[model samples]
Target: MRFYPYKLACLLAFGCFVSVTWIKSIPSDEGSTVMPDLQILYKRLLVAEELGGQVSQDLSSILEQLRNLSKTGNDTYLYSVHNRTGFKVSVVLGIPTVKRDKQSYLVNTLSSLLFSLTSSQCQDLLIIVFVAETNLDYVNSVAETIMKNFPKEVQSGLLEVISPSQYYYPDFTSLKETFGDSKERVKWRTKQNLDFSFLMLYAQDKGTFYVQLEDDVVAKSGYYDEMKAYATNEASKPWLYLEFSQLGFIGKLFRTRDLPMIAEFFLMFHRDKPIDWLLDHILWVKVCNPEKDDKHCTEQKALLKQRYKPSLFQHVGLHSSLPGKLQHLKDKDFGKQTLYKAHNNPPAEVSSTLKHYQTHSLKSAYEGRDFFWAITPLQGDYILFNFSQPVYTSGYLFRSGNIETNGDKFFNTTVEVLPSSVLARHKVAIPHYRESGNGFIIVGEFVNGLAEGKIEAALQPVSALRLVVHSDSDVWALLSEILIKV
Candidate 1:
C-alpha cells in the first residue's frame, strides 16, 4: 500500500485551510458486516509512476477515454427531465420508500433536508421521491404529505413524487416464493435492488449527477454547501465515485451518464444477492479490469473511491423494512463534528443576565468542559459578548440547557453579529426544540451539548455579538459552551 500526501490547503468549500492525514493501511475484509471508511488515500500515481515518461504521449488517449465515459448516452428513451420552474438541475437526490406498519421517517427526513440546505444550493437541486410499495393507497398518502409540506418546492419543479408503473415493476410475489419463507431477508433485499434500479433510471436524465438515499435519514447542516466545496477540491482529480453516507444505498453518488450501466448491473444480479454487495462487486470490477493479469491495479483502483469524513447523513431511529430488525443508527461523526478548529482565545469580555447558576459562572463558558455548567435563563435574558477589536468572523456556536438532566429543553437564541465598520448586522435564527415535529434544535447540544450551526450572513469584520431570546423562556437556560471563529 502507498500513502499519498494531499496538501493541507484552504478547503475550497470552507475558505479555510485544514490539515488532513494520509496513511498507508491494509484493506478491510469485503464480507465484514461493518462498513469500511472507504476514504480515497490520495496518491499521484500518474506523476509518480506512469505519466513521467508518457505525459505528452498518452494525453490524448486519456482525454479520449474520459470523453467517451462522460458523453451523454445515445439512448433517448430516458426519464422525462421536467423542471416546472425551468431551472437547470445539477443534482438529483433519489429517495425510494416503502410502507411501514408503525414507523414513518419521511417527514422528518424531508424536513431535515430543507433546513440544512441554503437557498442558493436548492436552486439547482432536484429531489425525486420514488414510492416503491405494493399498496397504491399508501403511496398516494405519502405523496400527499410531501406535496402539503413542500408546496413551494413541489410547485417550483424542485421536487417530484412518483411511483413505478405496475407494468414495469410487477408484484414481487414470484421473487418471494422463489426465495422461500426461510430466506425472507434475501427476498426483501432482492426486491430492494430492483426498486433502487427503478429510482436510478428515473433520476438519470433529470440532472448531471444522481445520489440515492433511503427514506429515513437526516442530513448534516450545510450539506449542499459542503458538497460544493468538496466538488471544487476534486475538480482536478480523477475519481470513480464519491460516497456521501456510510449506509446501504444511501449516499452513493454517480454521474447521470453512468446510471444506465449501474442499473443494468443491478438487474443482472438482482436474484443472486443483496444490492449493497452487488454494488461493491460492480464498482470494484468497473474500476479494475478483471481480465488484467496485474494485481497492483486493483490496489490502486480501490483508492479512487472517496467519502466525507465523519459522515453527513444519519439514519433515523425506525423499524426496519426487513422483519426482526431493530435500528439505532448513529454515525461516528454526528454531534462531534468540528468544521474548523476552535479559536483558543476567548473574546475580550462576556456577560449574561443571571450570570451565575450556583457555582457555574459565565467566565467558565470556554473552559472546554461540559461538566462546568454556566447556566441561567430568565425573561428578557441576553448574553452580551464584547470584543476589544474587530476580527474576521467565520461563525459562532452556543450550547444551552443540558438535556440528559433536563430532558431536551432549549431557549430560542437569536445571534447578532455586528461588524466594526458597517451598519448592517448578520442575524442567525437558533431554534429551540418544542414537542412539535420540526427541525433538530439549532446549535442544541442535547445529547452532550455539542451542536454548532454556521453563520450564513454576509458581513464585515465583527465588533461584537449578542445572544438573546426572541420570546420569554419557558424553561431555565443552561450555557455549556460558547465558541466563535476569529
Candidate 2:
C-alpha cells in the first residue's frame, strides 16, 4: 500500500490559503456573533518525520484504500481522530444514520460536503457513512439510494457505506430500571450511543481524527478547510476537540485514541444518560475524578474544550427521526455572508418601507439564517445585489417562507439576473430569460410562496441580481434565503 504525505489543509483563496485578514466586510453588526474562522497556517506541518517515518498497517490500509478508491472503487473501515494531526492520515468524517424516516438528508449533506472541499484538502479526508440499521431490508434500501445518488463519489472512494450487526451492541438489561419514566426515550438515546460506538470502532482504522456529523447538516463553502486549519493550529492547546458547530453533535472533531474509552463509557451507562451528557461526564471523570456538582463537571469539561464562534455546520432537518420527538432547527449562514462583499447590508431603497425591519428585513435577508425570515414585502419594493464589478454568475437559490408561517409571503416572487458587460457586447439573451421591458432579464418566477421547486437556468456575466414582487399587495413577502452561485 502506498502512503501519501499530506500538506496542511488550509487553502483559503483560489491560489493559496489567504492571510487571516481575508474577511473584509460584514452584513450586520447585530445578530449571531459572526467572525472570521481564526486560522493561521501551522508552523509545524504534520510530516512523516513527526510520526517517526512509518505508520501502523491499519492506517496504511486506510490511506491506500482512499488512494485506490479513485481507481478501484473500494471502501475501508476507520475510527477516531488523534490529539494532533501531523502528516499522517488525519480526519475521517463519520456519519451514523438511521432510516426511521424516508425523507433522508444524506444526499443533500453529502453534496454540500463535496462542493465545500478545496482541491488540496480532497485527499486529506474521507467521509464514512454508517447505515446503522438493524433491519437488513431497510439497510439495503438506504444503500441503494446512496449508490444511485452518489455513484461517482462512491466509486472514487470519497464515501463508504457500512452497516454494523446487531450483535455488536452491549446488553443493557441491568440498566433498564434506570429509565423509570422515559423507557422509550432512553432506549432511543442508548441505541444512538451504541451505534456511535460501533461506528467509531468500525472506522477507527482509517485516520487519526474523526468528525461527528448528522445526516441532515449542510455546511458553508470551505468548511473542511476551516476545520482542518482549526485542528492543525489547535494541536498545542488544552482542548478536547475543536467544535465546528453548536447544534447537537454535528461537527465535533474527536481523537481516535479517545474512542475506546468513549465507546466503553456509552456501553457502561447506555441506558442512564444522553450521549452529549455522557461525553461531559467522561471528561469530568478525567479531570475532577469522582466529581459531583453538575455545574462543576460541565465547567471543568468546558475548560478543556474550544468551539468556533460562528459554527461551520447547520442542522437542516425539520421533522424528527424518532416518534414524538421534535427536531426543527434554524440554519446559520456565515462564510461570505459576513463580508457582505456583494452588497448585503442595506439594500438600495425599495418600495414604501426603508427601515424598522427585523424579520424579513434587508439585513436579515442575507444573514445566512437558513429558512429564517427573508426581507418582507412592501408596495413597489425591490432588493438588489449591486456588486462593485460585474460577476459571472450561473445560478441562484431562493427558498420561500416557512410553509406553516404563511408561505403566502412568497406570492409572485421573482429572481432577475441583469446581463453583464460581456453579454451586452454580444447582445445575446438567455433562451428562457428574456429581457424584460424594465431593462432587466427575468430568469426565474415563483407563483406560490415557495422557492421549493426545480432550479431555473443559469445566468452568466451578471452585473447585478435582484428580487422583486410582481403583485402589489399589503401582505408580507417572506424570503427564506438566497444564493447567487458563480
Candidate 3:
C-alpha cells in the first residue's frame, strides 16, 4: 500500500478513535417521531481524524459505504446500535479519504467491521458503499472480505453499493438527439441524476411510496407522518409530477397523464433553461391547454386561478416568484391581517341574481334554512356570494307565505336569505338580466309572509342558473354562485 505521508500525518494529528452508540429501531406508528443515528455517525467521523493511518481509513470507508447504501437496492438494512435493552442501538461509521489515498486497504478494514457488527446485531440490512473512484475489482475484494468475516446469515445478500458512476454517466445519446445544445446536455445530465436515482429506488423497493431526499436536507420532526399523509392524498388523485421540495419556482401536483407531455415539451423548449425557469415555463405555458385528455389540466388551471388571481399569496400569484407560500396561509385567514390585505373585503350588498344554481333542496321555503353558494364556471374565477339572512326576512316577498318554484325542481336556481338579516330592508340592482335565455334568477324577501318576489332575469343561452346565497360570519355581503351552469 502506497501511504501518502501528508494524509497520514493529518489523520494522526486529529484524534480519531471513538465509540458510536445509536438507537436500534425505527418507529412503526404514524405520527411517531424518530431521529436517524446520523448525529452519532457524524461525531464518529469527526473523531476518526485522530485515529491515524489504517484506522482513519477504515472509518472513512464505512461512512462512504453507508451513504451509498441509501441509494442502492430494496433490502438495504437500517439499524441503530445501542448498549441498552428494550431499545435497540444502531451504529454507523465513516472514514474520509483524499483521491490518492490507500483506498483498497481502507475498504477491506471497513468491510470487516461492518461484517462483525451485522453478525452481532443479528439483523439483515442493505449495505451502502460510496467511493470517489470505484473499480469493480476493489469493490469485489471488499465484498469478499465482508463475506469471509461474518456468518452467512449476516453477510449473505445484505450489501448494496452505489457510486458516482451509477448516478452520473456519459451523455445519453437519445437525450442528446432530442436536445442538441451543450447547455441542454448539461441540464439533462443533472435531471438524469435526480430522476434516475428516484426511479431506481422506486423500482427496487416494494414500499407504497418512495421518498427521495437530497444530501444537504435534514428531516424535520413528524416529517415521516407528513410525507405519509401527502403520499396517501396524492395516490387518491392522478398526479404525475409530485415534488417533495420547493424548486424555487411553481411547484405543482401534476396529473400522471400530463407527465409525458411535459417531459416532451421540456425536451423541445427547455433543455437549456435553468431548473427554476424550466419549471416556470412548463407550469405557465405548456400545461394550460384545456383540450388535453387529462382533466387535471383544467383542474390545475382552475386551482391556479382560485389561488393566484391576485398577488395574495405570493406563491399563488400568476407571476409569483415564491412558490408554496400560499401553503403557509390558511384559506380563511389569507387576506384578513397584513400591512396590505391581498383579498378585498366583500361588498356590503351584492345585487347579482343566480343565473343558475343548485341547492339540492326540494322545498323552496327551506332554501333560506340550508347553506348555499356559487363558484365561477371558468377555472380560477372568483366565488361570489351574499350574506345569509333569516327566512323571516325573505318571507315578506313570497305570496303563499313560502317561497315556491315552478316545475324546474331538480336544478332550479332559487335565491335564499341568511338567518341573521331579518330586519334590514335593502334593494339590489339586477345587472345584465334577460328572459329568453337558459338560466333564471329569483329575488325575494322573507318577512311575516313571503312577499316582494321577482323571477324574470334570464341567463345566456346554453347557460343555466347556478345556486346563489350569502354568508354572514366574516364580511357581510350579497351574491353567490354555488354551482356551474350547464
Best by TM-score: 1
Candidate 2 lDDT score at position 48: 26
How close is each model in CA RMSD to the real structure? 17.4, 18.2, 27.5
Model 3 bad stretches (over 4 Å): 1-168, 171-205, 241-244, 248-287, 290-486
**TM-score of each candidate structure, all chains considered together:** 0.55, 0.52, 0.25
What are the per-residue Cα lDDT tens digits for candidate 3 across 9-33?
Answer: 2122112221111122212346755
CA lDDT of each prediction against the hidden true structure: 0.57, 0.58, 0.30
Our tally of clashes for model 1 stands at 1
Task: Write the residue-wise lDDT of candidate 2 on 31-69 in tens digits.
Answer: 756545432122122332233223233333433443443
lDDT of 1 by residue, 185-218 (tens): 7678877887887677556666776778888887
User: Candidate 3, residue 465: CA error in Å?
Assistant: 72
- In angstroms, how far off is 262's CA in candidate 3? 8.5
Question: In model 3, how large is the Cα lDDT of residue 138?
Answer: 51
